[model samples]
Target: MSRALKATAIRLTSASALAVTVLTAVGAAPASASTLTDGISATARAENGNGACAHGGYVGGPNQSSSCYGGTTTAHAWCADFAGWVWARNGVTGLSTLDDRAASFMDYGKKYGTISNTPHVGDAVVYNYNGSDYADHVALVTAVSGGTVTITGGNQGARPGHVSTNATSSYSVGSLPWGQRISGYVSPAGSNTPSLPNPASLPAGTLVKSPNGPDVKVIINGAGIPVAASDVTPDKYDLSKIVLVDDTAFRALPSAPASGTVVHDQAGGANRYVVIDGTALLIGAEDWTAAGYNDRADMGVPTAWLQNAAQRQLTTGIVVMDQTGKDPKRYVMVDGAALYISGSEWTADEYNTQTLMGVPGEWLKAAAKKVPSTGTVLMDQSGTDPSRYVMLNGAAVHISAAEWTANGYDKRSLMGVPGGWLASTVSAQVSNGTIVKDASGANATVYVMAGGVAVPLSYADFTGFGYDKRPLEGAPGEWLVSAAAKAAPADGTMLLSPDSNTVWQVVGGKKKAMTADQFGEGKLSFNDVVGVPTAFTAKFPTV
Candidate 1:
């Protein structure tokens, strides 16, 4: 229920009494019982239409700095502005000072070390996307009951309603739900006990310089100095989530923690990373001189340096296979592990001439079979796909390879036996296989798909372009059924794949790909042709 602000008489209390109440509520003192709680509710000016938003204009309209607490330059989707105003009025120092975007609460929580999973009245709950810096939405906790909490937030409805309590959806405080979208709640001032250890107190390998100065540009390599330079760590924190036809990169972060003062257990190893100076450094490697202090080499940011709780859950125990070469003898890695082929096991002469019965898919399955244990064979990629393969050790694992996981590859310690298995979910992945035909053979502009995602095969590269590409040998179920066999959809009607997960539409008698998320976008609109189209069977290339 939401409403516009209505003036009402409030009971008057002494200044000292008001101060005591706020402090008591924040501290939840010993005198206050926790078990038999009265429960907390909104204490801010969160009443609907209560703030200046009633008088404020729309987004891109004139800025009413005086009325809107200078939260936004101009009136635009003022959910955050309204929230900021309420917090500021309640003397929430951080919200009042940095009230601009709805996501500003995330930064506020990080800076003051006031973020919590446990719900409390007057706390700000934030929702972030992917690993982004900004939050998508925020609400004020109005009440708490068991696992759920009631929230009062602006822009709760489709029309950007005023502050009201909405309970259609709730988030978890005990554990992560899917992408770890909810960034957690921010406690009001004085109710927090934060422990931010000094650099020397943090784990070794933590990159520390000063409180607010230039990064020493040194890297901590656990207890030992693995050469002061970035010979070991990957560089650039920006990772691409989807790659499109034109080779454009598309990345999205649904929820990421506030980008400051965090600790990550690097891949479950002994090495720990603490965010010092807004940069991630390993613990125990805090010795400045050990980093080649005087002539320290640049240890730039690593890709997605800090893994939040959700990321850690997704990455832990997930295995990916990295294959390079004509046959199994060369190199094959399953979750960073490789079958060691010592010495010149295969000289240039012996390697190229070895007689192999099948394609890379067959070889991959064969190699995986050699492993004692492997996960179900749900996905595979051929040798000639245009996208770069394994930029580093098992790079595909870094990218969100949905199809790989969909193909019975999740929750496994090792790659399963070389055969296909049934999957509960089947997401899309743009196949990097070669097009039916190419001039330079550099790569096919388009690729083909059979059981798994499309890829250019070594044999097909010289055979009949992409037209002759056949379904994989051991593919199970209708996933391997030819796309040509499927009936075209009605002109305007978008159709989900035979798997009931993929979505596409036939326009002017041609196939046009679109985002699968649209299935939950309420209804189809004029811009039904919303996203770019490609032929990954169930998936489209991300740009």
Candidate 2:
């Protein structure tokens, strides 16, 4: 209803006060004797046509009056304000603890022990409550019939800033919009609470289902784990403990269940699997007891879900070995592959401090014997040789100690490989954009790798182009001496002389001076400019 029409109705009601008084004098119940629910309903209905609820823009507008905003001209999100006003007018206590935020109503209910899952007349329904401290909206539940609830709320229209009318909406029980759900229902302080289970207080391992779907999930470590319907049995799981929640609250939980949970196929299959680091690993029937998993419950899940989860490999940094002691080798997972961990390296990297998960011998056999992922730092721990190398381009490149510290390689986790892998000749060169200098020579020159050749960088260029801030890795002196040398920057490289304002774009082996307008027209940024020595820029002819 529009506020203009409501004003006319108010005027007509005022003119009929005498007639109403005469009728009440006979047998009608007076307004003062109305119940709390009736009072809340009447107050909310009377506010429908008051004015458009405004957040801030409607300072002096009809909605931003003293009645709701404490006489201040500034308007705020007033849905809570309107609700609080109606509650306080009806003499509901705890208005002092209430605020303008919708979440405060949930807090109020908890403090008063009046929060529940079932809705009742005069209850405040909170939407999008994530169990901690967030809720999107709140409204007064004016009616609760079979499978449906009717609510009236202020600031309820589509337009946020200038919503004009208090609105009423009806939703079938547990059927709120996506990403929004009734988190809880808060009744008035002294009302008799319903006997439904409160999801917030439910313990871990409790089963829960969303009203939107038929799937049931068990709560593990605050995450939802899907359980097949066939797996839900009377002896295994208590069906009566399943709490019904909305989709938003269900999805807000962690997607994957906790690690170390055992599971099997829904149809009572013989194959069993254990979840570790979000991946499911098959546990052989013979090895299950040896792996210390004989007592764990093997929960049944959908077959397709188990297969999809098995596709993910165990996460890196987990240490694992065979439980039967057949291989007697410990390996650390990296990029879905296992790299054998030498005894010395294991102690140095503190792998001994981590828990070692035991798997079947076949799983260990399949994961072993693969090269460590590229960029892994490796060292030969079998002998006294102190050489350290970096795996790049499928080969090891020798890196000196000075380079290791300068490039922050010392901070990376070092994996020990067999001495045979490090004895092979260096086949990979330093990649482009890497800064290198010969550490064996006195006052060695700093160079940047370009086109597989080392190009000397002047001190001014090194600092001006911001290359000094990058890690300077040391290459073998013999390798740098034999490598080709480049006199000019690579073609298509953008260069800027340290002393000049002109920006040069290298094209077709020539330097082309770019104007300010041309640089802007080409959508080029000065941040891409590489400061280089004037002598290097002079090698390219101006075109």
Candidate with top TM-score is 2
Per-residue CA lDDT of model 1 for 139-193, tens digit only, reads 6766666766667766554343455675424555422332224556766543211
Please give the range of 10 consecutive residues that has the lowest summed lDDT in model 1. 242-251
Clashing pairs in 2: 52-164, 66-71
Off by over 4 Å in 2: 1-207, 210-216, 219-223, 227-242, 245-259, 267-270, 284-296, 374-394, 397-543
Which runs in model 1 stand beyond 4 Å of their true positions? Answer: 1-46, 49-52, 55-74, 129-132, 173-180, 191-543
- Superposition error at 317 for model 1 (Å): 70
What TM-score does candidate 2 reach? 0.39
Candidate lDDT scores, in order, read 0.35, 0.60
Tens digits of per-residue lDDT, candidate 2, 237-307, equal 67787887644466466656567778776556688788877788888766788776778876665555677
Per-candidate TM-score against the hidden true structure: 0.25, 0.39
Superposed by TM-score, candidate 1 places the C-alpha of residue 93 at a distance from the truth, in angstroms, of 2.3
lDDT for model 2: 0.60
